[model samples]
Target chain A: MKRTDVTARLLPKLVKASASAEQFAPSNIALCKYWGKRDAELNLPINASLSVSLDYLGTHTRLIPIEGQVDEVWLNGQQLQPGARFSRKVSAFIDLFRRDQTLCFKVETRNNIPTAAGLASSASGFAALTLALNDALALDLPPEALSILARMGSGSACRSLFEGFVEWRMGQREDGLDSHGIPLDASWPGFCIGLVEVDAAEKAVDSRSGMQRTVETAHLYQSWPLQAAADMSKLQQAIQERDFSLLGQTAEQNALSMHATMIASWPPLLYWQPDSVAAMQKVWQLRAQGLELYFTMDAGPNLKLLFQRQDRDVVLQHFPNLETVEPFGSE
Target chain B: MKRTDVTARLLPKLVKASASAEQFAPSNIALCKYWGKRDAELNLPINASLSVSLDYLGTHTRLIPIEGQVDEVWLNGQQLQPGARFSRKVSAFIDLFRRDQTLCFKVETRNNIPTAAGLASSASGFAALTLALNDALALDLPPEALSILARMGSGSACRSLFEGFVEWRMGQREDGLDSHGIPLDASWPGFCIGLVEVDAAEKAVDSRSGMQRTVETAHLYQSWPLQAAADMSKLQQAIQERDFSLLGQTAEQNALSMHATMIASWPPLLYWQPDSVAAMQKVWQLRAQGLELYFTMDAGPNLKLLFQRQDRDVVLQHFPNLETVEPFGSE
Candidate 1:
């Protein structure tokens, strides 16, 4: 059946269930490391990372099914053709989860977060898809399991499956069935992080191609497993002790390590821009002058500054020239 | 006491000494991490480094006596002309080193090292001058103390004081008088390091400017002290164990960290060429397939791959496509 027909059929059902069902978008922060791909087909990581779902800075998506055999999925009202960039992955996602059901999805996605800005748009998109689909289908699977399925879509997506601090354990299981997201705790809300949106420009290479490059040519990727282990341990301890210093220091180095792997990767490309470096330098300079501001960058110029709420103004003043985006509502 | 008359007297001394001394030339490696001026008068590093002084690669120098009252130095037989691009620190080095001497010299030098290739030609040139001048003047400073003085000229030049492994210590005192070089060991044989030299063919930015850019803009430079400390410890362990895996792993990461700091440096400029990354990738690909081959790069396109002497052929066979240049005497 044509995608239009499928969407025509699925839209009615989606609207009835989610008259106001909103999708949530979250920006991604690379935790320990996710430099190489072990299974590109599955989008699995050689080493797992722990990340928090940024509830305030992500896309909110809602899916509505039409009456008849819904023909396709439409994102932001744009019908992607069969051979389109997102088609294979979206089709595979739908086919894997709703194989017996013929439903078209109207993915009304409002992205509060930037797309392809290296803040893990894929993570937010996939996690929102997982959440929206689960709500639409009424399939009551745990968030942990949903993330494992989402990992098949994008590796970092698994981390957004949890709230607060989370870890995607790099299970040694050969089938990769056991690798899934686990929350450090569903109850911790004091873990506050600020997003300093410097620039929201798209990157030259997306995460998929970037990871593939690292796996294919980064000789240093071989050492990532050991380093990730060390970093992960440090990250866990930092989170537990609420050590923002260690957290900021570790994240910056991990990001540097990831970029290092990229440079060492074949046909080496730099994911960083002059602005991105400038953003980081500005943060460092402010911090050096005794301002306790620690900044972490994902894959782009925008930075995630993790600090205590009391110090928000102190940190916020550092980026006074930059247009700031608050992570949570009302401060 | 004009420069010409000074050269007339000094050149004869240089000629007399050259006739009896064995000519030596050492290639320079830019530390990439340029610290503050040890003596703003004499450009120097806050720390020491291990540099591979390329024997066959260096400046051609002929010191000839000319009619002069004061000593004069010329590059490529040109009169010590004004506004010729060299390390700005050059002026201070000449003035201070010759402060006590009346020996006038007409020194001419032709360099093969790419000027401003972000590679330290000044380090090599001055180091070679240090050796050549010692031969000419018979000052007879010990190699260690000579290295200290050369370091006062350029940080990495001290690395040229020794043949094999070198460690540049970031001394505690700020005066930099204590800043000196120490050999890794007395008898460690020369490890096989393969070089791939690319002619940058353009006047590259000198290390001083590059470092000043780093100091002014690179917030990432703030992180280098910690990284250097970690690297120094790990490197010592690796050298002690003779563990190629650890050595390669640490060196590769250190080089990348150094580059990352550069990338993060503001007004960001890259010292790397496309070919530099390509060479890096080739090594990575070969290493991924279980080749114990390891690589490190200085400022230019040339990569120094530390391959086992026994497995050198095996490693070289993998990259039949890449143009490989053997070190001076390698058959």
Candidate 2:
């Protein structure tokens, strides 16, 4: 109680700070879902996961250097007070940038992608923040090192720094030095993600909390980590071979399996809305009718269809609302 | 070509009926979802399952014994043409009654619950049809014998005949003698089911075909049978002990696990609608706020909440539209 005399009651906000920067990072759709955490301290995932970074949807975060001690945050251009949960989230994320503890950095993050709506905004948001800070602080960290730092902010964020296909390998080391995104491929030229965004009114339970609850309660989750590892290898090979059918099938199964673990958790967490179910059924119907396409969903209602660039017309014919975003590294 | 077989083309709808009877059976919500099949010929489930028959919603079938080559099916008073899929299903079902194959009986079935919407109308439908046929055909079958016969009609239908907690055990024998619903308890006095009905414009893939695909693929489905058996026993004991917390938690987890198996299938079968997800979220939110309740969904969008009668007022407060049904056997 006596310590309040000399010390600040709260952590410092960016009311007054110095260095600042701005950067953009694309969103990623997990072909393999990251459903559980092996280590909560380092934000390490239980299973290795693969994702394709999206070129269309992304987060553009601009760091505004304020002169105050406490860091402020503005998301989607809305001002967030210093001590709020969101501001603290930003400050805590920026604090993960190794060399800075004394100086406060205000982060102004805008998501073209919706935040906390199962759209993987956290992935793009933290990825953008980490990358911007990299240039601003002149960290000179390579993609792998930066991925490790980004993972400290959000598990899926590590995969967003890379352009094309990325894998967040759940390493065995306790220090999490090896737990970082490995760029699987720089190009998936013929494949595109047909993103059907579903605007859910409420935010889902965040991935962190969802994973924690799943790991603690879901008995069926015991076998998922090993299964994901096997799937990751098969998918990587499928990509290398340019086998669209194999790649699409494995990605679809992987996404479903990941959701299964969460769905099996005590009190269950279901991410699919009615529209999501309808969209999935439609995908099945299309494939049954000889359409060479597959679909996967993240933690939210937005569905990503993996189909060839050649079959884009047919896919568009069925899902007129699907926003076609070229796979990362396609441009 | 041979002579045009025009004379046998027309099968009489209701030529000369010897016996007829009408019966009603309530729909059952599977707490432990049955996904795969061990014996398709006998309609045996791949795993043991537990279910609670809903008192509020049911099916009523009127058996019209007809002297014809084939059975005609009239669902909700609409006559289905002979040799159609629905007629064939009815014919095949009635054929399991151990009667002369040449004796065709017309089945007029009506469901208070929606059919094929995942609310398990087939279970109730087949159960009522079988029970009615038992009386009409003068087949003096006990509940166990009738359950086995119902199982041959539809896998889940075996559980619909009994009240309170029921388990459909996947028997050890290949002959399927022991694989029938064993009523765990006759009454759960304090409990009630809050039902939220959702309308689906289209029918999902029926359970039979869905199970076939899931069993053939879905790497995670291999261990579900044994896991389900284990869960069945634990759930049975929980119901016997009247431990609502343990019962509710296990039921919720078991339902999710069953859905997980299907969701992980080759072409994932998701039965939840938007309203289904919303209702489930509401249940989780209620539990978090210290409400003692649990939820489970069948293969459709409709959701059933299990809570004590004492908690009915609060449950109704949140879900004013929820149809409150007392536990079966309470009357």
Model 2, docking class: acceptable
Candidate 1 positional error at B93, Å: 15
lDDT of 2 by residue, A26-82 (tens): 889887778777677677777888888887689998876556677778888898888
RMSD of each: 12.6, 8.0
Give per-residue lDDT, candidate 1, residue A49.
84
Global lDDT of each candidate: 0.59, 0.75
Looking at candidate 1 chain B, the ten consecutive residues that score lowest on lDDT are: B13-22
For residues A170-269, write the lDDT of model 1, one tens digit per residue. Answer: 7765445667778785333344566665443343667677778766655555555665676798888887877777776776666665665566454555
- Name the lDDT of candidate 1: 0.59
Worst 10 residues of 2 chain A by lDDT: A1-10
TM-score of each: 0.57, 0.78
Top-TM-score structure, candidate number: 2
Clashes of each: 42, 16
